[model samples]
Each structure stands twice: as C-alpha cells, then as structure tokens.
Target: MKHYTSLLFISSLLFCWMFISCKSTQRLTDWSLVWEENFNQKKGFNEQVWSKIPRGGADWDNYMTDFDSCYAMRKGKLVLRGIVNHTQLNDTAPYLTGGVYSKGKKVFSDGRIEIRVKLDPAKGAWPAIWMLAENADWPVGGEIDIMERLNHDSIVYQTVHSYYTYTLGLREYPKSGSKGMIDPDCYNVFAVEMYPDSLSFYINNIHTFTYPRIQTIEKGQYPFNQPFYLLIDMQLGGSWVGTVDPKELPVEMKVDWVRFYQQKSIK
Candidate 1:
C-alpha cells in the first residue's frame, strides 16, 4: 500500500509539471501574426519595405553597396553577399557587401520578430540580423543584435547594447546577452520577444536567455521599449571579425523569411 501511494504521488506531480510547462510555452503561441516576408520576387526586396543600406565609414557598412553582384533572389530566398571587388571597375573598395534596412517603412515595439537564415561561414565573414531605434542615435537609444555569427563560429551571439552597457560598462550584473549553438550549414531561426519590461531571445524556438529591465537611474539602461527598425547585412572584414581572407570572398547569407507578431491583446 505504501509503495502504491508513493507511485500515485509521483504521477500526480509529473502531470502538474507537464501542465505548467505547456502553459508557459502557450504564452508565446498567444501572439498573433502581424507581418511577414517570403522574398518571392527576383527584383530584390520590396522597395516599399526595405531600402539598400547606404555605405558608411564604419566597418559594418563601409563595404555596403547596392551593386547587382551584392544582392539576389534565388530559390525564394533573399541572398546578401560579400564579394571581392571583381566588378564595378570604377569603384575602389576592395570588397563590396549587400545590406538592407527597414527604417521608415516598418518599425515596431513590444512584439516578437523571427528571422530564418542560413549563414555561410568564411574566414572573414560577419553576418548579422539586428535592430536599432528608429528615432534615436545608436548606443543612446539601444541596439538589439538578434544574431551575429563571426567567421566559422558554431554558435551565434544574441546581444543588447545601450549606454549602460557600452559607455558605463555595467553589463556584468544583468549580462546583456548570450550565445547559442547553431548548425552552421543549415537554416536556423533566430528570434526575440521584446516587451516593455524585458527581452527574451531564442534560437530554433528554444529559449536561450532574457535581458530584463533592472531598477537603475542610469540612462539607456532599458531603452528598448520604443519603436525600432531592422537591419540585415552581409559584412566582411570587420575589426571584430578580423581582416578578410580574399580566398573566402563571395560568402553569402540566405534569408528564408521574416515574421513579426504582436500580443493578441495589443489590438
């Protein structure tokens, strides 16, 4: 009788645990799909939603170009490439990379966004899918790096940077971000759920980490509650990722699709 009672108690506890686990994951399913992209057209991305990222002096965008060789739509995917300057005889930059941003056309707050991509690893390749505040300057407003894969890393980094983290350097307490292992050769889903109080990151639907808003008087500690725009780029030879290996030129990042969802209660 004692053994039977013990078994019954254990069964009851297991059932409760499974129920709670399902409820927790059901919170994410409660979101309603608001926007999505499949990249079905061949004339590059929808201009109404995305604009070619302009060249900048910064390493990330220094090689950004709208050259034909840098962008393509193949097999229903958006392909952004980083290639050695073999064409554009007039251009002087040794490398040219493809990038796009949705600043004015699409901006959202307090929502979940997911991107499915396949990263091609190369010695100097640095591909990223990230977001920045639409109306505020960088580091001041905040930067949310959903995914950043450097070189041939088997894991992708998901990070958040703000004045607190970058200027004041207060990242140790809250731990701004984390890394997740990924299959370098296959498509992986990188996502983030941005709320007014915290940001939850996930890789392939598995929760990785969460950066929560902490009680502090510091500026930019949690500036992610505002609307932000997206930036997807195929970068090469950045200071963080080191110098480019010419032999590894023509690397690419294939984006299968992107989707944005908001809490069902939002509207």
Candidate 2:
C-alpha cells in the first residue's frame, strides 16, 4: 500500500511540474522561431517576402500623405526614409518613403510574431509594424497593431479592431521623460503571441499586455482563426502624429529583422 501511495505522489509532482513549465513556455517571449527575417546581410528588399503598397494619400488610420520612399532588402531589413519638399501639395518631395505588406505572400493564423526595429525621431514621422486579417474589408476581418509610434509624442501604441464591436481603442506605452529623443538609432523589439482564446504583447522580452478571450468574438465570428499578413510602414503626418516639420528634412525608420514562431502542439 505504501509503495502505491509513493508512486501516486511522484506522479502528481511530475504532473504539476509539467503544467508549470508549459504555462511559462506559453509566454510571448518564450516561443521558438518558426519563421524569421534576420536581415543579417545583403541589400535591397526581398520581393518574394514583401510587397510595396506604393505612395497614396489613402488616410490609412488617419494618416495623410500621397507617397513616401520605402524599401526592403533580401537581407531582411526594411528601410523607410522621409523626404521634405516644396514642390507639390502631397509631394513631401525629396523624401524617400512608403509602406510594405506581406499581403499575397505571407499570412499567419495563430502563432508568435516579432519585429526588431528602430524609429526615426523626427516630428511627424509615424512608424508601425502590425497585422491585418486576410478577409475582404478591414475592421470586418480584424486588425492587430503590435507596434506603432507617434514621433512627436515619443509613445508607442498596441491596439486591436474587430467587427464584433464598433469602438476604437488602444493601449499605449509611452517613453519615459529621461529616455530623451526616441529615434531610429535605438533599436527595439516588439512582439505578440496569439492563441485560440487570447493574445499577448511583449517589448524586448518583457510581457506588457494581454487581451482575454472574453473581449473576443464568438468562434464563428473570430476572424483571427484565418491567416493574417504583416505590415511595416512610415507615415509623414496626419491627425495622430500631426504635420511634418518643414525643417526636419529626411527621416528614416530602420528595421533589423522580423520573425515568427509557433509552439508545438501537445499530442
């Protein structure tokens, strides 16, 4: 009888340890890489992995601008340089800028996504790395903003928009006063872990926020179950970041790498 009791206790302890380890591994930073853009070397963008959206004043997320010079390279890095010009109304001329998306090429369903990037501190420069649902219209398919920074404010925002609700909302991480100018020179990592019932965000391996299942739509309406593509861009100005400073000529957002990971399912 004692032998059997000892065996049962041992089993319980093993089970508990396994459970705790699993919970820890589920953390946003703990996921292992399934896909990655290291941008280790090379020059120019990888056409197979990215698609440029071209220059247009479409007011995406209240941003105003016709076009900007945006570039991507096979080395895995993406660069967006802002130019200032006095030629045309939307012609923030001399500036090289624009945005890129993994629209037709890549999309993810449920996994961990991470991007390592640097932002340009110039006023009116807005940079973001985010995701969009694969469906035909937006907000209807859902939008997940993993990282977005307003240059003037020196603050970053993470947000989600879903058709299940009609409200616009966001969670923010503002830079401390002592941090000084938030610019492209200082690199940062932004990441998200997506699960069936929840999603979480992390900055440089530090867990910052979590959105629970209660805030999501029902299973049938969950647009996140389908594949979603990634986007990286820099906007000149608009409602959020305000207008670009006429004096601040060329500004750029530099990206080091973009990576994706998935946890192994328990069989």
C-alpha lDDT of all candidate models, in order: 0.92, 0.66
Residue lDDT tens for model 2, 90-186: 5444444567788989888688888888777777787778888766477777777888787655557776666553333322211111112233457
Clashes of 1: 0
Enumerate residue pairs that collide in model 1: none
Model 2: weakest 10-residue lDDT segment is 171-180
Candidate 2 at residue 225, lDDT? Answer: 60
Q: How many residue pairs clash in each candidate?
A: 0, 13
What candidate 2 gets wrong by more than 4 Å, as runs, is 1-30, 61-69, 72-76, 85-96, 165-185, 215-222
